[model samples]
Target: MITQQRKLVTELPGPISKSLAQRRVAAVSSAVSGGSDIYVAGAEGAILLDVDGNQIIDFGSGIGVTSVGHSDPRVVAAVTEQAASFGHTCFMVNPYENYIELCEKIAEVTPGDFDKRSVLLNSGAEAVENAVKIARAYTGRQAVVVFDHAYHGRTNLTMAMTAKVSPYKDGFGPFAPEIYRVGMAYPYRWPTGPENCAEEAFADFVGQVHIQVGEQHVAAVVLEPIQGEGGFIVPAPGFLAKLVEWCHANGVVFIADEVQSGFCRTGAWFAVEHEGIVPDLITTAKALGGGLPIAAVTGRAEIMNAPVPGGLGGTFGGNPLSCAAALAAIETMEAEDLPGKARRIGEVLSARLTALATQFPQIGEVRGRGAMMAIEIIVPDGSKAPDAALTKAVVAACIRRGVAMLSCGSFGNVIRMLPPLVSDISLIEDAMDVLAEAFAEVLG
Candidate 1:
């Protein structure tokens, strides 16, 4: 008989973890992305074990980088076996089956009735860059449009694509030119609310584009299905569908940045599927590789064929080990019905967080799809004002209680939740209870 994994012991960053963190500070670059110094020695389904014999519940899933549980046996075995056979042949020089098989799987999964093709890359940034390149080549346009509060990637072109300041774009300057920004469908901050709010705001954004640069020069209009690092802002109803319609009418290629929203994170393989709209190009990364690093750009065959033979590819893109891991991960999601799992997870969490919002006025908003969730914290009143201080306090409280969480938002006022889809429901309940207790302690 199998037993449920439990997170035990206390003392937040155990002693050994604390020591290792100190060592990490000296050896690792300061530019790494992480909140604190929690050193994880081992992990399983939703549980993290520290070097000091302490266990903690993880809610971030390595920043949504791991959709499957930590160290999934199938993924581990496949990657290990593949690495032992042939680690790196560089697909550009020597072709491989794993890459082609993974691409076929992507074509089969990505939403669309058209003949779709996919290109593999090493990271989300590369996928975004490739998507933009393909769009320009196909449309013969020089401009791309992205929305405000959108989180694409961290590379130079993607840096320009992202809509936040501070940590992401503070010192990085002279970003890729010709990238335009428009208003995003943020219901919480949309003063009038999500009514005709979408129609009015989007129309205004369209007007701005036409007046500034004209639609004739645009290539693609890209937006995250659900803003990941931008407060998990799910667009209002009809917003995405309407955007696709407008793009089609104006001859602009429609692109969905699903780097964080695809692969069952949102109760669906791709969040855009929820609207039944087919994007010309869709980018996926985080969860695509199970736990390994792999990204892809899946789209219409004609558009994808725009780039010439030598136009796209990287040295390590679609590495054999990573491709094998992706194929195994895709199989796992299908066999386990993880998309259904995401739906169940969302129902349970939304119910819990909605109830907590009544008691805690700081929870200004709680919105997301499936497991890709977030809780926005504001001051006592539901004003546009940010309560980042309170947000930080709640996070500290959770860390103190042996639960690992990650925070994100335009103003750093949101507590994001992207727990592994394969995590135990009991573990999820445990984490939620701990989170409620943290809110209690911090707010009181």
Candidate 2:
């Protein structure tokens, strides 16, 4: 189903999508961000057929969800089979085997063998909120420490933990209190270079957290192994493990928000594995259900058991259909050796971007792991001036040329990539060629 595409046919929004947007505006909530033009109709592998009949390469993977690609045969079959058999029974009320089976699988794959446990949820944000809840329940502490440039979720508690303020927390205030914000080990934007040593940077950031929040009152310290939406920025080497050690020493649980970087997106099941560090809790979503809404909060058995029986249950929290899809997705990942494939994809993608950087002056920084990647666009040489206009132009150019691109960052200046791990290698190379042309059109 990896068909080739070559034409835009109409404007990026096209007349059809614009009309749909008109109707959508009348019905949908305005609070939701994004455009109607980019709406998708069908997807398979790396290509998306939009409402306008335009076939676009899906570089964002629905914000990093469809790892095996949209509508994979196995996932579709599993969903259909489960939906036909039984849809809902509510885990807290009736329970089921799939949930238990999925939990066992997650425990097997997740880092840290010390009797890990997991609980399924509806979305990444919910898992994150639950992780903090478990940490608080276990440690009997009130304060939780978060880092700058970290994005956990949009839920009330998660919003408080999130770093950016503009859209995610603009009007919503009085976020859950006792939450403290600390600096991160972001190397690209750091005053020091990659050689500055992330171990040293993390040590400094941890010291600042204890000085400000006081370790005695802290429940947990949450962070992203690779900051997603905060620019696909990866923390420097030794940073993650060192921070976990610091938290453990201070009796603070360490939470890894791997919702966007988990699975095979980082060439590993979890980005934390890159440093051989096991998180006290790991929140995962996006690619877990193959496209369906599903998430999980996995952690050490003791911490997972901290919460009371009735404390964690959702009406739709482990929807059977999603569980089935997740089962299939997990199977597909292993069968396809996606972790190895993901690492190869990163090698190719990073190489292409590195070459593009040499030819174009606009691509400021190329950073990320596996298929999850990005390029920070700046105004000029060595300047941090966010080039939102330039970034928008690049995306527009790509859409016009039948290629879909997505921009993210607090300033909307970073062009992030999240192509499906199952995408055709040649198609990725083709997209790279188109991107090179788009860069010329926008930056020249």
Candidate 3:
């Protein structure tokens, strides 16, 4: 097994990785962007072994996909065992026990005491699309409401629901209709102030739905408890609960897109649990599959069953191998108490990042829950203007120094950290040290 440590044997994207990059430029579409040119050979725990014989610390967790750690033994073993028996046998055509078992596990963990049902899918986008479909079917409404800075997916309907435009929805015009965008209770950038963000934003959101979309015409109100690609933006306290309450009262299906905040990434099974809100439908992916391609929309039985037979499902929705991996991942989460581990990681991140902010005025704010944390970069000119260039420089500096980092936000000025739950505290501390060095080098 590769040692779990950061060791740069050669420059990042060394000979082999450079060669792979050249080949990729020739074969792969330029449309598929990546964080770095460093090609990965293998990964274990919180370390990634690059093709150039470098072990880089992983703080992104494959964009929050491998929460149980890369190549977790349990997930690998389960997938291997299941693949040996059967790989595909469309659940809709020929049902399987593992599929049912995984759904049962999802229900037990997902926040809700009411009986729930689930429909497995292949990706987060697919799950979001299906969630909207189910909500429309149940409510008999045409409009779907989403918040600003929210990222749902890349599908036509999802792209319409998503807020970003540059890469996700740019030029992909003529999107699905009946999608309405509303303001989010972003405490960091709220116009009035952070203190009034929750109540004011909630009021604006409700008023917009009432005037623009009309309450009765809305099918669902979809949101990420902690916005993902939208900079890990954690909505103000009471904002989520108010929205859920309004959704229930107005007969709008509340869909929580927990793709990035689900599993143990947020110190809870789902970020909504932090707000004590039970969504009518919850779309999950990313970490749920333990690196496999699987997503699900689990929610109330009445709403889920509204869709008639043959209304939901895809050819590879619940592949036996993916189901096996999910079951093992859930088992690992429970047995290891990864939620508590995430809380500890959050403590370390909050402390280190908060302290760093004191040294670098460019770091405007530090916020997040559990391992899902971020720092918004701003110009030190006292105006708090976004500093995308500085953000990019800091991330590049960290990558060159062997700590893999990722940045995201509406203005691309937020540095987000999502280290694996199994990462050693010492390893995380080392990564933070590298981050501080990168910030100092860039700012100085």
C-alpha lDDT values of all predictions: 0.87, 0.86, 0.94
* Superposed Cα deviation of residue 175, candidate 3 (Å): 0.3
Q: Alpha-carbon error at 301 in model 3, in Å?
A: 0.2
**Model 1, residue 18: C-alpha shift (Å):** 1.4
TM-score of each: 0.97, 0.97, 0.99
> What ranges in model 2 sit over 4 Å off?
1-7
Q: Per-prediction RMSD in angstroms? A: 1.5, 1.5, 0.7
Candidate 2: C-alpha lDDT: 0.86
Question: Model 1, residue 26: displacement in angstroms?
Answer: 2.1
Q: Residue-wise lDDT of candidate 3 within 4-72, one digit each (tens)? A: 889998987689988998999889999999679998999999999998889999999999999999999
- Give me the displacement of residue 137 in model 3, in angstroms: 0.2
Return the top candidate by TM-score: 3
> Tens digits of per-residue lDDT for model 2 on 1-444?
647554566777777778888888899898888532666778787788878877788888889999988888899999999989999998888898898888888888899879988889999999999998999999999888888888889999989988889899999998899888877777877776777858667767768776887778999988899989788888888888788888889888999999999998989998988889989999999999999999999989999999888887699888888999999999999999898888888888999999998997778899998888899998775677889899989888887777778888867889988888987787788788989999998766
Residue range 1-444, candidate 1, lDDT tens digits? 113354456576777778888888899898886576677777876777777666777788888877887887789999999989999999999999999999998999988879988889999889998999999999999899999888888899999998997788889898999999988888888867778678877887789899987999999999998988888998888889888998899899999999999999999988998888889999999889988999999999999999999898989999999999998888889999999998888988898899889988889888998998889998875465889998898988888777888888999999998888988788778878888999999878
